[model samples]
Target: MIWTIKKAIYRAMHGSLKVMMVLFNLPEPELFTGAGSSLKIPEVVKSKGINNVLVVTDKVLMELNLLEGLFNSLKENNVEYKVFDDVSENPTIQNVEDGLKLYLEGKCAGIIAFGGGSPMDCAKAIGARAVNPKRSVLVMKGLFKVRRKIPPLFTIPTTAGTGSETTIAAVIKDPDTHEKFAIVDMKLIPIVAALDPELMVGLPPHITSSTGMDALTHAVEAYIGVCGNKLTNENAEKATKLIFENLEEVYKDGLNLEKRNNMALASYYAGVAFTRAGVGYVHAIAHNMGGLYGVPHGLANAVILPYILEFSRKDAEEKLAGLAIAGGIGTPIESNEELSYRFIEKVKAMNKNMGIPSSIKEIQIKDIPLIAERAVKEGNPDYPVPKIMNQKECEGIIRKLLP
Candidate 1:
């Protein structure tokens, strides 16, 4: 009876939050897409009267010379830029502080996030810290805390996942507590985004598979969550279909620019959907894994998605059936029960074929309790999941992933 009452209260809060989001009419980034879209950004930055910029990215991408074209374009456009390539895989708060120092020293007028999610997240945090000089990143944790406007922020995603380019979130980790949290506010949304498939064609097969699955998780969680509206549902459905059609094809043939382009679009759509509608326990759990074990975010999401779906399958049955049909895995004539099971099976098959493991080797038996606590804390009263799980139930689910 107590649990039932708590769920009812949670549902009421979710309803109120959904109404507020619809009325707010959140904005999306101005987009540049296709094979050479990233080069267009320098011209736009110049037109915006941004004389100097900070480019945030990871060292691996710098070593790969992946940013060579963007750098050349920035030079040609006369946009003075400083590069901060110290961002980590999960992007620590220290990375943000270091980047902010570079932004200040370079007298940068704007920011260009030029890698995967880590760079984008680090860039967003730097912007937030720059504008709100008195507020620490830890203080800005949770919703609507960053009231100040960030500098002109532009994002270019090298990976077709995380959708950090389009999302109103900047996920950062604290090294001391090993806690990963998000700073979610409209202020963090990028002013512009470039989706260039050329930059994605060189990604390794494992990175390609994991990131594609991450996009699918975003779409699935958004569509089945209670906060979804017409726009989010449409975007999620389109994203799901595109991911189903293109992810594996691109994974097998990483050089296929057309398939890569499709996956990029799918990631953007999923990002847009989840930004407004909210994601569920998969994200909550994945964030914890990234924080605790230093697991890559997409890899953790890829491994945890199927387990979360199975846990919520009964409650999300009709929605999963709809997604099954939208993803071209089931017909409209199929029963919801059958379709739902088929959707879960399809996710399992995708993981298996892509060489993603069913269990995470980094997850230790002793840490299950802590992970479950943090996951439930992050998820409940915000995620609006189809089913509300307590810590005990969450522990049971996490235990399955122990290797």
Candidate 2:
């Protein structure tokens, strides 16, 4: 069966990679799986012998009283902590600087990225600053130049989007320039990721919907990306299914525990898949738009997903067909093009069902030149994304949403 072959390939790749790591000087992330993952916090901190932790969170988390359980657990374990609730949606360089000041001043042993991606990213930047405070974090933009070993770090994601919890990248927008920059060193990757569905139970419907679409975008990009290995493929496929089946139900009823659990798990798997396989032009472009426009990350991904898929369908047919099948479209389609288009249409329909906007104009449609130009140059350059687009092509993708 296909599932059997996929399972076998995943095992072989994971196994051989580990073997070569010790024998051939290869490197990768420290793999940790957390199904019932809450206790992982204590485990990783204790294992690393981290005596004190600076919990980087945000205002909403502190206001809504969402962090009580985790704080209680840390208190019970005798872990000294400080709270920094200043991180914003698109985290700024100032946010990182302030957080880093707190981290150093508290003399915390490690970091706990205890909120969504913004706080998580702030935590990474704070840790990176701790090691090499003099270096311009902006100068270390693209790959593997994180100069020093950061302190022991852990991430607990309260929402499902952005996956900064498990990824080796942190996106911070410079307040002075209002241009987004990402630091993609392996040092940014967390030591352990804690995915607790209970934490997401408080998410409002709008946040739930947008974050779910973010996960869906991750799977779509990973499945279709050129660098997709067998392991990434399996995770993407399973994550796609989980999102399509559960995202809408949870949107309509945010209190649905089962759907929340499914979305949380899907978000984690999507993070793992995209971390290895790489995201595509949608993400690259979306980042620019978010930085410039103040649009939410997931909302940007949701609005542009179908339009970008339509543009890339011819080049990404086979992979798009795989996603179509995963989304429950059958082989009865007349042609590969038709199948791919149908899948795009299905995503649009899903977005509609979840109350997402049908076009970029809904959130933003400005600074086309800057957004398109920077998209190609940012975030992912190493992986094999399906599309090989130039500036004109990127501009065209932007024009689709223009009024």
Query: For every model shown, what is its TM-score relative to the native structure?
Result: 0.99, 0.88
RMSD to native, candidate 2 = 6.8
lDDT of 1 by residue, 241-352 (tens): 9999998888899999999999999999999999999999999999999999999889999999999999999999999999999999999998999999999999999999
Lowest lDDT block of 10, candidate 1: 17-26
> Candidate 2 — which residues are off by over 4 angstroms?
1-40, 331-335, 362-366, 379-383
> Whole-model Cα lDDT per candidate?
0.94, 0.78
Tens digits of per-residue lDDT for model 2, 1-403 = 7645644554454455434323522223344443446645865676677778899999999999877877877877778898889999989988988988898889998998888888998898889888988876676666677899678778888897777777777888887766777787777778777777777888988889888889989988888866667777888888888998898888888777778888877887788777766777778778876787767889888988988788778889988888778777747555777788888988899889878876666334457777777886663244346656557778788888665
Q: Which regions of candidate 1 deviate over 4 angstroms?
A: none
Q: CA shift at 197, candidate 2, in angstroms? A: 0.6
